[model samples]
Target: MAVVGLPPMGCLPIVITLNSPHGLKQRGCLDSYSSVARNYNKILQNELQFMHNSLAMFGARISYVDIYEPLMEMIQGPKKFGFDKIFNGCCGTGYLETSFLCNPLSYTCPDATKYMFWDSIHPTEKTYYYLFKNTLPILDFLLKD
Candidate 1:
């Protein structure tokens, strides 16, 4: 089984929107939120590793896939991934709105591929593809071993 870690919550469009004094103007992630993600990921990784070891005798293979670093890299250098919108999503105002909040009345961006997020909290398909690519090595290793 493969378990994926949490992405940087600080980079969430809604998080960046409501937390920042400058609102959508700030494309960068909030340090406090990101730090929490980092710490949580570290703990998750450690626990997964322990589980993997404990289950090894039973022929269980548990691979911990890290999505946080890869997503953070994309957020830091979105242009490299052909992403122009890093701080906002493709739906609505790309700010606080998400899920049920984004309905027919909401305004969406012209191209979702250019955006990192599809909603306030989720990544776009394009972003997910990039993240998959980034985690390919780990997945490959998991399959091979």
Candidate 2:
């Protein structure tokens, strides 16, 4: 089994819109929120490590997948991963719109593959593909006999 870590929530479109002083005009992630996510990841990593060690006697194979760094790398360098938009979603304005707000009537970008997020709170398929690709090594290790 592999435990996947949380992505940078501060970089989420909704979070940035709600937390940033400049709102949509803001660039990059909110440091405070990112700090909170980092702290949580640290605790989670430690707990997972402890669980893996303690369960080793029973032959439990547990692995922790660090999704933060790779996701951040993609956000920071979208072009490297064939992505064009990192800060906004492909649905509506890519800022505050989500779920019901980003419905059939909403304005969606022509190419969702170019954006990292599908809506304000969710990632696009392209982003998810990258995340899955990065976790392959961890999954392989955990599944190894």
Candidate 3:
């Protein structure tokens, strides 16, 4: 018989590194009650600071990609498409319409093709396209060099 050993936990450190704060938030995550949630942003920020410092220690070039500005611009300011889309999603009912409630049983919006959010948590295909078009510059900046 052959004996098996567990794989080394290489992901634990990377998990800590990635979870450190970038100040970004997902919908409904703001209302979470976990203690980790309270300090999540700070932890993430600190983690990024640590990474930046570590990179500097090794004399590696680092750059920041700020996609938030363009994403916000698309959401608030005028754009070439879906000028009237503001609230409500193309899937589910009320606020929790995401996959949780919007799947299999709940009522979905009549016309998904014309809505911004597909569910509460995800953007509709059309919305994604619009956002993608506007975010090209940021994407280019990140992919450059």
TM-score of each: 0.91, 0.93, 0.46
Pairs of residues clashing in candidate 1: none
Best by TM-score: 2
Off by over 4 Å in 1: 143-145
Instruction: Give candidate 2's whole-model lDDT.
Output: 0.88
Predicted candidate 2 versus true structure: per-residue lDDT over 1-145, tens digit per residue: 7887888889998999888889867657887888888889999999999999999999998888888899899988889988888888899989889989988899999999999999988999888898999889888888888
Question: In every candidate, how many clashes are there?
Answer: 0, 0, 3
lDDT of each: 0.87, 0.88, 0.44
Best candidate, lDDT-wise? Answer: 2
TM-score of 3: 0.46
lDDT tens digits by residue: candidate 1, 1-145: 7899888888898888889888756567888998998899899889999999999899888888889988988988888999998888899888878889888888889999999998899899999898888888877877884
lDDT pick, better of 1 and 3: 1
Error of model 3, residue 88, in angstroms: 1.4
Predicted candidate 3 versus true structure: per-residue lDDT over 63-111, tens digit per residue: 3333233334445553445534433456554244555667777787667
- Candidate 3: lDDT over CA atoms? 0.44
